[model samples]
Target chain A: MKAKVTVRLKSGVLDPQGRAVQHAAESLGLQGIQEIRLGKVFDIELETTDETEIEKILETLATKILANPVMENYEWEIIQS
Target chain B: MKAKVTVRLKSGVLDPQGRAVQHAAESLGLQGIQEIRLGKVFDIELETTDETEIEKILETLATKILANPVMENYEWEIIQS
Candidate 1:
């Protein structure tokens, strides 16, 4: 099984880097583009096939690996291909 | 119209930040988590509704703001509510 995770800053967060990207995008002629936020995605190839175990693993991953519990929030979906 | 842009390092690229996060995740007891890659996503609330115009805009945005033309690639989807 494979899992893909996306981690992002909560809405209303101050993301200076994202703001910079937005500015640069606008300068590049991307009209109507307002705000930009940056985030992280993880592509994990796992060894297990159990759904329950994967859920438990993802919980730990989110709390410890995928995000900073204090500042970020994450969502993930498992991919079986 | 709103747009979401996801920017990432091309496959096969080495992302040190991602690796660091992966290690961190593993240490946090995230079993079955192997490799990690960090990326950026942008949420833009646009003023225009024309798809053609948005495409042109995204071209410029990706080339200039969303990614480094030299090392990164980006994909974006428009959202209508």
Candidate 2:
């Protein structure tokens, strides 16, 4: 199965990199951009086709190996099976 | 409109960070892992609701401001309008 996991900072979390990107974009003269929040995406390819196993593995990987529960929130979905 | 932009290294590009994560995950006793590719996500909020304008802005932002055309590919989608 193929899965995607996305991890992003919580709404109240500080995102300096995102701010920098926003500043840079604004400086580039692109108008109407109010905000830009950055995050991480993990595209995972696995051997298993079982949806249950994929979900369990993605959940564990997202929480334990990828995202920090305190400041970031994570979501994952199976794309191909 | 609210839009999302995802940028990832091209298929042939080297991704050291993703390799490190893969190694770390393997060492953590997690099985069935074949590959992990890392990417970046930008959640952007714009003031305009026009679809054509949003697309034009997003295309410019993704190519010129966010992604490196030599090594990375980017895709964007409108989430809300």
Best by lDDT: 2
- Estimated TM-score for each candidate: 0.86, 0.97
**Which regions of candidate 1 deviate over 4 angstroms?**
none
RMSD of model 1 against the true structure? 2.0
User: Compared with the true structure, what per-residue lDDT tens digits does model 2 show for residues B1-81?
Assistant: 899999999999989988888888888887898999999999999999999999999999998989999999999999965
Candidate number 1, chain A TM-score: 0.92
Q: Which stretches of candidate 2 lie over 4 Å from their true place?
A: none
Model 1 CAPRI quality:
medium
Residue A64, candidate 1: how far off, in angstroms? 1.8
What's the lDDT for residue A66 in model 1?
Answer: 70
Tens digits of lDDT, candidate 1, A1-81: 887788888886788888888777766655566666777777776788897888788778777667886778899988986
- Scoring only the A-chain of each prediction against the true A-chain gives TM-scores of 0.92, 0.96
Least accurate 10 contiguous residues by lDDT in model 1 chain A: A26-35
The lDDT per prediction is 0.77, 0.93
